[model samples]
Target chain A: MACSCVAAHLFHGGDFGMSVVIQQIVTGLSIGGVYALLAVGYALIYSVFDFSNFAFGCVMMVSAFVAYYSILAGCSVAMGIALAIAVGILFSVFIELIAYRPLRKKNTSRLFLMITGIGIDMAVTNTAVNLLGANYRPFPNVSVTEPIMMGNIAVGKIDIIALIVSLVALGILWVFLEKTKPGLAIRASAYDTSTAGIMGINVNQVSIIVFVISGVVAAIAGIFFGMKYAIYPSMGTVSTKAFIASVIGGLGNLEGAVIGGIILGLLETFVSGYISSTYRDLFSYGLLILVLLFMPGGLLAKSKSDKL
Target chain B: MKRKLLALLLAAAMVLSLAACGSKEGSDLPGITAGKTIKIGFVGFLSGQDAYLGQGAKMALEDYIEELNAKGGILGKKVELIAYDIGMDPNTETANACNRLIQQDKVVAIIGPESTEQAMVAIPIVTEGKVPMVVTTASNPLVTVAEDGTLNKYMYRMCFTDPYQGTALANFAYNDLGLRNTAFLGDVTNIYCEGIQNCYRDEFTKIGGSIATEEGMMASDVDFRAQLTTIAESGADSILLATGSYKVVSFVAKQMRQLGLDLTLLGVDGWYANELLDLAGPELEGSFMTNMVSDDDPIFADYIEKFTAKHPGTTPNVYAYYALDAMMSIEWAINQAGVANSTEIMNKLETMKDVPVFTDKLTIEPDTHNPHNKTVSIIQITDSQFKTYKLYTPEDK
Candidate 1:
């Protein structure tokens, strides 16, 4: 139905017609895949902690820099990815331990936690700026710059790889959450942190686990973003979309995060492709408002009227 | 009674010192005595994200000053630069800097606060303070003229206004390059981009070139694939990139190629950065852009060599050249006026003609307060480097 809606716009006199629509969809899916990785990470933390992690974008930035410098130091792309993941996990865990754990122990309000996240984000961004100057550093050894031509439509190899990897990662996470014992503990903590602790689930360990997962996800997304765009200090600003995606998906629901991300990406591309690129953001934010007003629980969110 | 007397004496001493400190900085107006050093005020971003731009302008101004002093100074008095860092926020810091330059430093003239926002802020202060300021590289039309078309007589700009560059691009694309149909892509959020884009549209349409589509994106956007795809199908042979960031230009160029949109890319001065080459070298191989001055031009050869010698490991960018031009304008005004008085210099600047600067022999139009008859160099990316395509001057309509 969405494809048809886009196709209808093309009949108004585009040369390439349906091919342009196909290309836009491919690009949208790729960006959406990256957004999903970030949204799910945000949702994971929110489910347990009940606060937005504004610093999530900064962690992605750190990972991108790690990956960028690693490549510059003559490491292979695979090696760079591995190093980024390690650094991302370390940085996220450290932020949690230093900034969040103590606050959580004090039983501070969620607003305080959100403020701390903002502070951390600003500090990280400033430090990165001072350390590495604000020049755009393009990712090296991204071998798939060429697009594969399927008939008349062009498909980026990186986009295909990104989409497949994101789906696979999300699938594995789903299996882990549904079938594994530790995953059950995480779910329990998501339901009620104090009750989970009382039931001997070790909520602090779950927090660590959640952050580690977030790190891994951020590392992958950051690398892809760096490849698609260039690595810069403020590349984490793109995480604004992920935050919006999580909101549209229902803040703490992983499945909803995926759906919301894809929806946002597809709608953004459609707006840009058919209508006007300037309206793309306006449309996305408009959809966000409409979703909040009408379906606050989000598209795939479970019935939680009290939570809303 | 003795302690009270001591306190009163201390207060008197502090007031006397304050009065002395005020005198040391001299009068709150731009002027020069026969043997007194001429104070030139400079305000720009010194520390923050835009520090590099400010530093470039500062260094260029300082280098020019050093050269002037070595050559027996302007009007036989040493030219002293009183520079203040505006930091980042133009709204608050620019006013303070302009005020300090006018009231405290008592500079003969002021230069810079390079961005349009800071330049506009300096206008009211400079006018009230009765000081003349030559802003370096604030290209907006409203920098010198208000929205109501009232001129800010005290303010002048070193670079060509935004409309001039846009018209030049449109003329070059239509008459020179023979491009009949084109598409426009610009950052809607940036005034610089929008200004040029609007002018280009107006001129391009007036010249009989058909615009297939016009698109807008945010300055912060890193992705241009969706936009490029739409542009590809727009049936245009070329596209105009009115974005202010080299990063965005490179992204668009690369994505355009990735999607197999093989159209000619035309850009503004924003695409002239070195990093643009690194980001999308092959993609932008045949693309064209408009710039202030061509490096290959003999006019800037001496200035470039001297500037490079003065500042090692760095060649001067457009900001440096614009700063040099601003300094030259000030020197010319002082020579023409036969004094360093602000009102006299401003009067000289208004009717300034045939003043030779590093880029061109400049003539500031009294009405617009922008340099007239300035050449816009057309640059093309050839073999991963900027090559001088042409030195174009848009014919007066």
Candidate 2:
């Protein structure tokens, strides 16, 4: 049904014919797959902490740089990817310990935690600018750049790689959350941190687990982002889409984040394909407002009227 | 919490004040006590990505000022430079820089605040201060002229506009390279990108060529496969990037090549940087760039030597050359007018033409204030060197 809606909106007046729309949707799904990876990371953090990690994009940036310099240091792309994820997990854990933990210890208001995240984001971004000298650098040639031709439609190698990796990561994440004991602890924390602690669910351990997962996934997202585009200090700014996607899918809901991300990506590509490339953001943001006004809980969010 | 907020605010204020200090290193400025110093204020970006340009500009202006002073100065008064560094794209920083130049420094003329974005912020203050300023190397057309297309009285550009950049690309792609089916990718919110894209498109279509695909990237976008895949299906023979950032363009170019498409990569002035070789690497070897100034000019051989000597190991781009030219151009006007007054200098500049600078013969086109009769050179990266491909004038009057 969503595919049909995309086709209807993507074709500008049945005059251009029934072609090229499938190509746009496939490409969009790939792009959306990367966005979903980043969005789910954001959603996972938000679910447990109940505050946005504005610094989430910066963690991805650190991953990209780690992967970039690792490759330059004679490591293979796959090794760099692994090293980046490992580094991302460590860095995310460190940030949670230093920046977020202090606020939690103080029993601070949500505003202060959000502000601290912004400060962390700014600090990380500035440090990168100072260290990297603000030049955009690309990751070493890694992913297969050639596109696989499937009849009339074409699929890029990087897009396919991104989609497959993101799907696998999300699947693993789903299974972990649903079937594992630690996942149950995380879920308890997500319900209520105070209550979770009272129920002997070590909230601190759960926080570490959440950070590690989010950070590892973001590492993939960042490296893929650098592979797709070039890595620069300001690449974090582009991750604004992930935050928006999370919001669209209903913040704090991992499944909703993936759905929202894919939806946003499809709508963006359709607008660019059909209406005008310039109006793509205008349409996407407009849709975001409509969703917020009409369905505030998001598309697949669980019933939590009090939360809304 | 209140105390913490106060400390943070105080820290921020201290940093800002330090940036605004603009450091009075060279203002020993002969003739200051004699009331005969021709004070000219300058603003160059000493921070951020384009900081190298600022450092070069500052070096060039200081060198030029010393040379003029050694030669008994402009119209017998020693040229004193009051310089400031615009840290980044902070509006408050721009406002403060402009305010310091006009109000605090009391300079007779002003030079710079690079890029059209900062220049735009500096415009109203310079206009209100009635201090004629020569902005360096920013190609956006609206910097010299108003959004309504009327010329601003106080601001002047030291480089060619985007329309000229567009003309160079179209003529080179059509007449020289024989590419008719071209695709364009640009960021919509960027004035420089949008302006050049529109100009290139108009000129390309006007000359019987058709655009294969037009794709837009948001300022924060990193993925171009969606657009690249779409363009591949459209069968564009070449791709022209109107995105202002070299990194963004290089990424797009790399992706285009990697997508198994054999397409010619074309670029605007934004692509001409020393760091481009590293960013784009072999992917951009055969790529062509339309630039305002070609490096092959024999006239600037001496200037180039001096600039490289001053800032050893830094290869100067068109921006550095323009900064050198801007300083010299202002000095020429001061000499021609026989006074350091702003009004007289502006009038002298208005009627001034045929003045040879670092680039070529330059003129402030009667009312538009654009550099007239300037040649836009088409160059390509051959074996990592910017080899000259072709040259054509955007306007000839």
Highest lDDT, which number? 1
* Candidate 1 residue B362 C-alpha distance from true site, Å: 2.1
- Residue-level lDDT for B92 in candidate 2: 70
Give the distance in Å from residue B240's predicted Cα in candidate 1 to where it truly belongs.
1.0
Query: Residue B288 CA error for candidate 1 (Å)?
Result: 0.6
lDDT of 2 by residue, A1-308 (tens): 23322332333234333457777788678778877888898888888888888788888999999999999899988899999999999988998999899889999987888889888888999999887877777677564444565544446678787888888888898899889999888887888888989999999999999999978987899988888777878788756888888889998888888999999898887777666666878887888898889888677777532221
Every model's DockQ, to 2 decimals?
0.35, 0.21
- Local accuracy by lDDT, each model: 0.82, 0.77
On a 0 to 100 scale, what is the lDDT of residue A129 in model 1? 83
Q: Give candidate 1 misplaced runs (Cα > 4 Å).
A: A1-15, A303-308, B1-36, B47-52, B299-302, B394-397
Where's the lowest-lDDT run of ten residues in candidate 1 chain A?
Answer: A3-12
lDDT minimum window of 10 residues, candidate 1 chain B: B26-35
- Ten consecutive residues with minimal summed lDDT in candidate 2 chain B? B25-34
